[model samples]
Target: MAGIQFTDSAQTYLADLLSKQNTDGIGIRVFITQPGTPYAETCIAYCKPGEEKEDDQKLQLEQILVWLDGISVPFLDDALVDYATDRMGGQLTIKAPNAKVPMVNEDSPLNERINYLLQTEINPGLASHGGDVKLVDVVEGGIAILQFGGGCQGCGMVDVTLKEGIEKTMIARIPEITGVRDVTDHTVKENAYY
Candidate 1:
């Protein structure tokens, strides 16, 4: 599913933008932030030489090179990048129909399905408290080890959030998950929500 369409006009415009940067091997990196959530945003950033992540997929367009963010690939499915000229100069637009849509199924790997629920269902609720969770690993016995970040890492209510919110949501959606465990060191309180 590596089919991200970049319109000819967008290629031209992006190529021109890169050339003006006066840097060799400069390219554009495309990604969606907060993907699978209503707050998702498609972004294009100038990527200097060696700025791309190891997992980024490179696409050579007619006039430009694009580095697609690995984690954002599924959400970017059917995405369109185009440039349109109005009465004013012109505007570059990115239309990603699937950016806010979660993509996963029972056939998907356990890790993928769990992460999908975390990003789509659980994290959005946590984000309101300036926190989120990451799947550290899926150990034996269908156990999911997670690490909390941001406000959740050291929050006072982390235990409640873990059991009542995250764990409940994960187990309900993916029955194969025998249980969820938190690996976060909650003593740090630096960014705790409460």
Candidate 2:
């Protein structure tokens, strides 16, 4: 409601597009599809008149109605909706730098920050090896207790993967995370990749 900036040209373009559509009373909805993770997305879709919940933040432009989920409004603060033309046909883009970036703040809870980093950055990489990591707990003195699964549970290279890959990344990204301890039972060796 307060953060979205619908420029004149953008309004014109969107109005034109909407006018051409078969939408009776429906409008445009801007939303964050995946709130966190590397695949976090900011998108727009045509919404039926009844599709929008009352709590959804509705931005009533002079030419068109734009609806955003209440939760998405904060992430889209100071966002710009614009149309850009090139050699080919023009494209409408939502320029919201803060939208897709994970909410990893130093003042946030240490466990929350660590979980954000792991889900958004670390786990995606490990997933390539049929593995994943989870935060069991964050203990005193900023030590992180983690558990590994899938291919990482019993791999011989898991130690190297932890020290060189996981620890290094976590420590570098989060200065407060002084140490990471993997509590996975490597002796099981059921699904080790190597």
Candidate 3:
């Protein structure tokens, strides 16, 4: 999924709005319209036993339009929704991966250097923990989506290791890497050793 990148501030705003409107068991569903549509809409409806109430459906649609007034409608088109848990509490993050207007070179010399660092320096260092990192894909704006393997699949320290270790090392070696994201889905792994 390639799209605009949302700042932490924008994500916080959207998450707060969703939390306020979330009731019953329904959470917010943020999705973009099919390509070429001018507006992206957000809908809120609870996941009921079988079906959702008509009133609730209408309310959600109305609320989304109101919500869009505050946020940019076009920018929210291609977004990623994820629940984040921190010391404070759990919150949702609406991410726009394609936010940067000017496209940067994903295959730049800097990226090659970073890839080399991950393949040679970082991967070897993680061998002790049975962890491996793979560069899944690089976005045009210098964001690298990585996948974790081996023990890192379900390791509690994966986040810390990624931030304090992997990310830190990558940033130190190459300054152009704006962000490193883990695209691993831990629940579906069938070959995890630890």
Candidate 4:
């Protein structure tokens, strides 16, 4: 899917904003906190030179540079960025379809449905602290296995995140997903954000 779609007005506004900043090789970075769920919110920031991380992805279009942090890619899939003006003033709007509940057909595969819930509904809550979760496998007996990574790997609240957040969300979004299991080894504190 296209990473992000920007309206013409949004492009112009961003370019103008960047030009005003005069920070060479710097542009806007788009990100989300609590992505793909009801509480998700998108944020934009001016990125100066050397601010971009090694693994960050850049989108250059129409004299603008849009940076996507690696950890936020999944949550931002098919997002729309726009600026609208009314009698009051200009307002920035972001339309993230996948940031909420993704459309699901009844016949969708169990694994696919669970994945959608994770990417669209569950994982966004974890993304705030640089965490993400992925589907490991779907086992027999309608068990949906998962592996928490990034900030979630060695998090102190992982159990709460899984049982209260992941499992409950999966069951609500996909009835076929009877249960969830986290197979990640959280002992390594290497990349734990908490």
> What ranges in model 4 sit over 4 Å off?
36-38, 100-194
Identify the leading candidate in terms of lDDT. Answer: 1
Residue lDDT tens for model 1, 74-169: 889889999999999999999997798678889988888888888777888899999999899999998899999999988889888888888888
Q: Candidate 3 residues 63-114, lDDT tens each?
A: 2222221123344546555556789977656555333221224465765566
Give stretches of model 1 more than 4 Å off: 106-194
Across residues 118-160, which tens digit of lDDT does each residue of candidate 4 receive? 7766777888988999888989887888898899888888999
Q: Is candidate 1 or candidate 3 better by lDDT?
A: 1
Clashing residue pairs, candidate 2?
none
lDDT score of residue 119 within candidate 1 = 77
Q: TM-score of the candidate numbered 4? A: 0.54
- How close is each model in CA RMSD to the real structure? 8.0, 5.8, 16.5, 10.7
Each prediction's whole-model lDDT (CA)? 0.89, 0.83, 0.56, 0.80
Can you rank all candidates by lDDT, best first?
Answer: 1, 2, 4, 3
Window of ten residues with lowest summed lDDT in model 3:
62-71
State the RMSD for candidate 2: 5.8
Q: Which residue ranges in model 2 land beyond 4 Å of their true spot?
A: 1-25, 30-46, 49-66, 73-102
